[model samples]
Target chain A: MTPLIEANRVSRTLADPEPFTLVCDASLSVAPGEMVAIVGPSGCGKSSLLYLLGLLDRPTSGSISIDGRVTEDLGEAERTHIRLERIGYVFQFHFLLPELTALANVALPMRRLARLTGDQIAERAAALLEKVGLGDGAGKRPERMSGGERQRVAIARALANDPAILLSDEPTGNLDSANTRMVIAEFQRLAHEEGRGVVCVTHDATVAAAADRRIHMLDGRIVAGD
Target chain B: MKGLMVLLDVAAAHLLMRVRQTVVAVAGVGVGVGFFLAVSGMMIGSQNDFIKTLIDSAPHIVASDEQRSAARQPALDAFPQAAVTVRGVRPQDEVRGLKDWPALLADARAIPGAVAAPTLVGAVAVRFAGRTEAVSLNGIDPRIEGKLAKIEESLIGGRLIDLEARPDGIIVTRPMADRLGAHVGDTLVVSSSAGTLQRMRIVALVDPDARAGFYAGDIAGYGLLRTAQVLFARPNVVNQIHVRLPNPQTAERDAARLEARWGYKWVSWEERSRDILNLLVVRDVIMYAVISAILVVASFGIYTAVSNSVADKRRDIAILRAMGFTERDVQVIFLAEGLAVGLIGVLVGFGLGTLLLEALSHAPLTMGGKPLVLPLDRGLRQYAVAGGASLVAALIAAWLPARKAASVDPVEILRGAA
Candidate 1:
């Protein structure tokens, strides 16, 4: 299968007291429906690699290609547009806006990414919630919901644009073992049944073992999966 | 859809949320508009009253032949060739440095501009009874005084006596009438500073100050030009010549040209009322200074309210920015809020100011139980001008804070805690 995402010798450096290279040289490629896991110890540039893959941060060198489009030379607006139209991200913490109800939060990305009418947004929001098993909790605000429910809403929001690849940075980091097992099972179903690639970073052996492939990072280089 | 929802939520928060700020801003504008309304109303009322009174009593102009000396006196430089040497008044003083009466009078009358030309003269008496009081006695031609001073309606009991044919009768003002203790057919004794006891019958009492005429016992006056001339002991002197112009507005302009040709200086009523206008101007200036401070302070209230809104909504503004709302959108929202405040405040002020004026109009300002009336029209205009100014001012006051709110950085909102 043709790779949906490809990174060629990407590195990120920051200038603090001295110039420090966060990621020296990293290269990776993944195809559609291929669930990959990248696991590393803390301070090993795990989050930096995710930011680079998500297009939230730019690499100091090398280029990223998504759906065959080279992105390193693109302007700020073009990059942001591409990120908005194609990418979905689930962070360690559910960064759902507290002001809106669970349904409103799920509806936000669809509303922002498209100019759908109010009824259309409502229908889509309801369908997305029902898929995430939160049909009854859609009306509850994020503060009133449990950590698992809010994370479920965040997952619904991330799947908003039906992107081919879902990038998650420790999705079950704040959930209990039961919620983690539920979220892990959902990711597995999304990859195998829904035909979408899921790349998750997790320290849980069982969580990482659930992925179709496990890529281990010692410092900044992937050592397990080529 | 998300942006709009966010915006609506923000706007609602502003509507129901910032209670203190909105009220203060609205009240500020309201007070400013109110003051403007009240002051403007009074000014318009007072000016209208003063102008109307002047229009009713005073002739539009006075175009008399200027003489070199006293009444009926020949010009200082007279025509030696004329028989009997009884030369009428001339209007210019330029010829031989002495103004002639008959020539100037004829020149002014021939201007095609002068509609009514009546000669007028008045005298002051220092002592009338055992007590001394200042009094003015006007000498006027009844045939033409009708157009000059409009004294016919001002007369109390008897008719105004004609000066062309002096009939030993005179008219006095109401206050003069009351002070003199004289009435119609009563003999008024007037002892001049010259020690001349000129006892004349009070034929008429003219009260231009009040619509109703009043009487005085010792005051005396007369109209017969010959009698006035004999009483004052001046052969050809008339103190002033009054004229009625076809148009009162162009009267001053015409009077200017008339003075140039006739060469005797004359003053327009407005010019003559310089002392009064100066007093009015000073009062108006002081009033504006005092009231404008009130308006400016109210605008300060607007300033505080808008800034306070800005401070409270900084995080909201940041959220809007993150949602892709441009800086201009943020600015426009705040400005719209300010405009709302201004509209409400101005409306409230306009209503209140008008109410106060209406109240003042009907409610007599009694001093010692005597009513002091205020004219209605002038008061209304004054209020309108003052109120309008304040509304405009309030909007101006709100502008800066709105701009500041628009420029707030979204990154700061994320980094900074409320």
Candidate 2:
């Protein structure tokens, strides 16, 4: 099967007073229907690579492609469009806008895509919340919900536009072990049963163990298990 | 369209979350607009009332003979473009009357909707019962001047048509009559600068108080055209022709046409009172300038409020950016906040301004130690202008902070947190 995301020898460098590298010469791919985990020590550039693969950051050298389309030369707006329509992200902090409720948070991406009517958006957002096992918390704001519930809502928000690939940077980093297990199970279900690729950067060994494949990185390079 | 809806929703949510800051911004704009409405309304309303007084008591159009400097020396016409300057040029002492004024008057009367009257105006002294008083002597065709100046409406003792009926008849103001201790039918001798004297009967008297507070109350007397022609030593001539119009608003256009056709100095009421009109313009400029300054200061309040909001919402901005919102979307959200604040302020300001004006109108007002009636303008158009100006000021102030929000780098922010 064709890979849903492909990164070929990508290297990202920072241009501060003294130049430094974030992700150096990393090559990887994740096919549809697979859950992959990127595990690393502190400052090993695992999150940086996740950002590069999600098209949130640009590489200083080499290219990354999503669903067979190369993205290095795309303009900012075109990149944003690609991210909106094809790739979804869930950060470690759950990052749901505190002002909006769970359902509204999930509806935000669909609203930006503008292909769905108000009723359709609401219906789909409710369905996504229920699928994430947070149906009862749909109307609750992020501040009122627990950290695990907020993370679940964030996951539902990531899937709002039915993106082909879900890129998560430490999706369970702030959650307790039970909530971390719940998130891992959801990621697994998304890849194995729902036919979407899932790539998560994580430090938790158990979270990494649940993935179908694990890519370990050190000093900005993938060292093993790519 | 849905995007805009969502943007407004988010903007409203942000503002609602920081309710205190939003209220402060709105109230600031409201105060500025409210003051603008009340102060400008009073000034403009009073000005309109004063202009109405001037228009009502003065001639709509005044046409006078153009004075010439010795017919331009005849030889100077040959060198029309000569660069040589003439110094202390003096005009020949010609009789002070329009030549062939009867034909000019006829032409003036021929114009549609024009009520024309010829007047030979001359400074004169009156002698009655061994007392003398200086006054303006107006030589008028009483029948036409009656309609042109509304003199018939202000008569106190006798009718104005008596000037036409009695050849040597005169109409004096009540003050002039009292100063002379003269009664109607009392004979008075009128003498002009030309050293001519004539005895005229006081056929009528007009009440000066009929049009109180108007400068037309100056001590004056009027007589038949023939009597004034003889007294002023200028026969069959008039120095001025006054015109009345069906619609006073057309006076300027009519004066332009008449001056161009007749080579006379045609002055409309507006031109005759240009100084007063200029004063009104200056007053309006100062009023609006000060009011706009208040709005600018209020806009600074909005600027600080929005800037603080942007600073506080950096996290939400980063997340929204990651969620595929373009920079422009972030900018629009903040801009919407500013506009919403300004709109709410304008609405509240309009209400407060109207209430204030209503309160002012009910309060006792005095001017020059006399009870005065306030002419307060409660027009919607002025409020609309004030509201629009406030909105523009607020938008300008909102622009800088919104730009800062849009230029935020999401990766840098998220990386710092990570």
Candidate 3:
């Protein structure tokens, strides 16, 4: 099966005053309907590799391709377009804008993408909230919601544009065990039932174990993967 | 369009988050705009009013016996090509009045919409009830002077035709009449600079309420041209020709044309009052500069508010960027915030400024001893200018922080947050 996202020998370095590498020569690929977990200890560049794969940061010396389109040479605008249409992101903190309610947060990406009418966008945002078990909380702001509910709202927002690749960085890190299990199950359902490629950078053991495939990293390079 | 709407929505949300800061910024802009409108309106209104009064009170164009440029030296004229340096070459003794002025007067009257009058201005002394006062006397043709100036409008007693009815008739200003303890129909002894003494009857008294009458009342007296000619011992001679045109704005061009053709010193109303007009121009420059400074200071408030918002919302900005918002989108969001404040401020300013002008106009005031109301030009152009300046200032202030926000490193921010 064709991979939804692929990275070839990707490396990211910071060169202010001195050279410091974040991701070094990392190569990875995740096929459709596959759940991949990148596991590492603190300061191991797992998040950095995920950022490189998500096209949020360019590799220092390697190329990245998303769904057969080479993105390394693409400009910032083009990369943003690809990110808007083909990929979704979830962070450790839900990062939902505190000024907006749950439904508005979910509708934000669709508004930027502008692929649907206002009514359609609203309906889809409500449906996404319902899918994440937050239908009754659509009007609730991030500050008004619990950590689990906020995380669920974040998940609904990430799925707004119906992206094929879901990239998350410690999405359940701030949630309780029950909330963690709920997020893990949602990720599983997205990967197995919905045919989406799910890649997560996590320090949680249960999250890593639940993935269809686990890639282990040390320092800044991928050490072992299948 | 949908993208822009979403950006505006986010911008509005951000502004709402800090309501006090936003209101302060908007109020700053409103005050700046309000002051700009009020001050500009007063300045422009007073200028236009002063110019109108000037044009009404004086001749549109004046042609005098004097020459704008001194005549070439007789020696130089005699030997055009020779480098002749003549010392103490005295000019010929001639009368200091326009020779053959009747023909010039005819030519002046021939001009379209021109009402021409001839006058002989001289210094004199009026002795009445044993009180003597020096006065500048204007010897005028009453029939033509009435047409060329608003002399009739300035009369508080008697009539302009009274000057023509009585051979020794004179129109003295009300203040001068008071100083001399004289009234209409009173005969007073007048002595001319030429040492000629005569008895003149006061035919009229001019009101000092009029701008022209104020000066006339201070030191000037008007009489029949024939009576003045006899009193000054200079017959059939006039030194000045005043010409009133239908449109005073065309005075400068008409004065130039007449001067070129007649070879006399033709002074337009604008030329006569050039110093005052230039002062007005300088006042306008200073006024605008001060107003611009106020707006700049006001925009700083906007800059501070927006900068604080940008700083507080850096994390949200990164998340939005990560969610696929382009740098331009981020810029638009902040720019919209600044513009929204400016737009609302302008509306508030217009309302406030109108009320201010209304209040000012009703204030009891006096100008040149005449009851006056404040003149305010409430033209739409002033509103446009004030609004445009405020919006431009706001946009400029917002641009710096928007650029900073757009250049934010989302990956770094996300990493740090992680």
* Residue lDDT tens for model 1, A1-226: 6676788998988886798776768888767877888888865766677677766668999878877788899875566556555667676667676667888777765665566787888888889889988999989988898999989988887876677778887888899998898889888888888878778877778888888888777677766673
Candidate closest to the true structure, highest lDDT: 3
Can you rank all candidates by lDDT, best first? 3, 2, 1
The per-candidate TM-score of the B chain, in the order shown, comes to 0.74, 0.82, 0.89
Candidate 2 stretches with Cα past 4 Å from truth are B68-93, B109-112, B127-132, B141-189, B194-213, B217-227, B233-235, B246-253
CA RMSD (A), model 3: 2.9
Per-candidate DockQ vs. reference: 0.13, 0.69, 0.80
Backbone clash count for every predicted candidate, in the order shown: 47, 0, 0
Give me the overall lDDT of model 1. 0.68
Q: What is the lDDT of every predicted structure here? A: 0.68, 0.87, 0.90
What class would a CAPRI assessor give candidate 2's docking?
A: medium
In Å, residue B73's CA in model 1 sits off its true spot by 24
How far in Å is the alpha carbon of B3 misplaced in model 2? 1.6
Best prediction by TM-score? 3
How does the DockQ of candidate 3 come out?
A: 0.80
lDDT of each residue in B273-315, candidate 1, tens digit only: 5688788888878877888888788878777876787887776
- Native-to-model Cα distance after best TM-score fit, residue A200 in candidate 2, in Å: 0.9
- Candidate 3: tens digits of C-alpha lDDT, residues B1-418: 5488999999999999999999999999999888888888899988888877777776788888888766668778898999898787666665688878888888888888889999898889999999998888888888888877677888877888888899898888888999999999899899998899999999998886755522334788889888888988989888899999988888999889888887889899999989989998998899899888988998998899889989998999999999999999999999888888888888888888888788878888987776888878999999999999999999999999999999999987988888
